[model samples]
Target: MTWKRLVAIAIVIAVGFVGTILAGGLLPSGLASAQQEHREHGAPSSAPAAGAPTIAAVAVDFKFTPPEIRIKAGQTVNLVLTNRGAILHDLIIPGLKFHAAAEPGKKGTASLTAAKPGTYEFYCSVPGHREAGMKGRLIVTR
Candidate 1:
């Protein structure tokens, strides 16, 4: 094959490899990590409404103490999140715009105003924490 043809084939192969990596998301090209970062830190959206009341939540090693909570509507609530685990964890409820951070063997507390009555999801934003059942629920009532 001519030298020009060989060079063209090499360039095509290089482009194909780059495209494959981009499509497969095997590289951290910033764009590919956008969604992953959001997913990792986007825990609050899983919460219920924001107009309910105050409720307390606690976090522990791979678990959330008082995994279930109940509260009233229109009443300000306080969530006492205490991280008893050996790693960092965060309590996020985007729907309520509530976020709390806890460190290993340390206690953390966060508060949120509940504007509606419903059940909200609570989980640890730490890697693999939620998947390990490090989660709970915020139940609001009127």
Candidate 2:
């Protein structure tokens, strides 16, 4: 083969390889790795125990359903986050330093223990998600 043809073929192969990696092919099960990374980053890894106080939140098209959550101080809460949109979503409580992510059409759970009686803000930490109205308020009672 000609040198120019060989170089062209090599370039095509390189591009395809890079594309595969960018598309998460290099990761061991994209979803699994993502969840593992979430846990490693201090995010809750499991759902609240059965019958525990659970708050279900649906994320769809840049909004969180039932945008306000109420809880009593010192209560443990299982935050059930479902991404109903065709994109990734997550619920993050900056005040409590907690976060969890869910892929499209999937669900994830995180546990939170309400601390002091106060109002805290929760939002999607994804870039531009919060600004797009992916936020809510958490009210804790004494």
Candidate 3:
């Protein structure tokens, strides 16, 4: 290749690398800010020191059985998710950054601590699942 073409390619690659590094740097700071915000406004009321409460649910064709769950604030919960359908399913609680997946005829469990008293939504992250009603409410009480 000609020197001019080589130089141009190198410049493009350098710029791309620099941009990637700069973008990566911003993410950690943004994550730290988000963690701080979660602590300030949405932190758990208390930590579970003993055995956690268990909640069980089954995933059947396009839906989650027992569409709602209730728990107390500061309680840690063991969520038992069973997929009894022909397809795969997973539970995702975005507010808590929790996810657990199970294939057909399988089971998955996730341990989560309840945050402040409020209603949070949990759903299957698989595309089109939520729209099809594979979702439910998680209510945390004081």
Q: Could you say which candidate leads in lDDT?
A: 2
Q: Total clashes, candidate 3? A: 0
* Model 1 poorest 10 in a row by lDDT: 43-52
Model 2 bad stretches (over 4 Å): 1-42, 45-47
Candidate 3: residue pairs that collide:
none
User: Model 1, which residues run further than 4 Å from truth?
Assistant: 1-56
Provide the lowest-lDDT 10-residue window in model 2. Answer: 37-46
Q: In model 1, what is the error at residue 103, expressed in angstroms?
A: 1.1
Candidates' lDDT values, in order?
Answer: 0.69, 0.82, 0.78
TM-score of each model, in listed order:
0.61, 0.67, 0.63
Q: What order do you get sorting by TM-score, best first?
A: 2, 3, 1
lDDT of 1 at 82: 68
lDDT of 1 by residue, 41-120 (tens): 54432233455344455677688778887777776655656667676778876567777776777756555677899999
- Candidate 1: residue 113 lDDT (0-100): 70
Full-model lDDT, candidate 2: 0.82
Query: Residue 65 in model 3: shift from native, Å?
Result: 1.2
Best by TM-score: 2
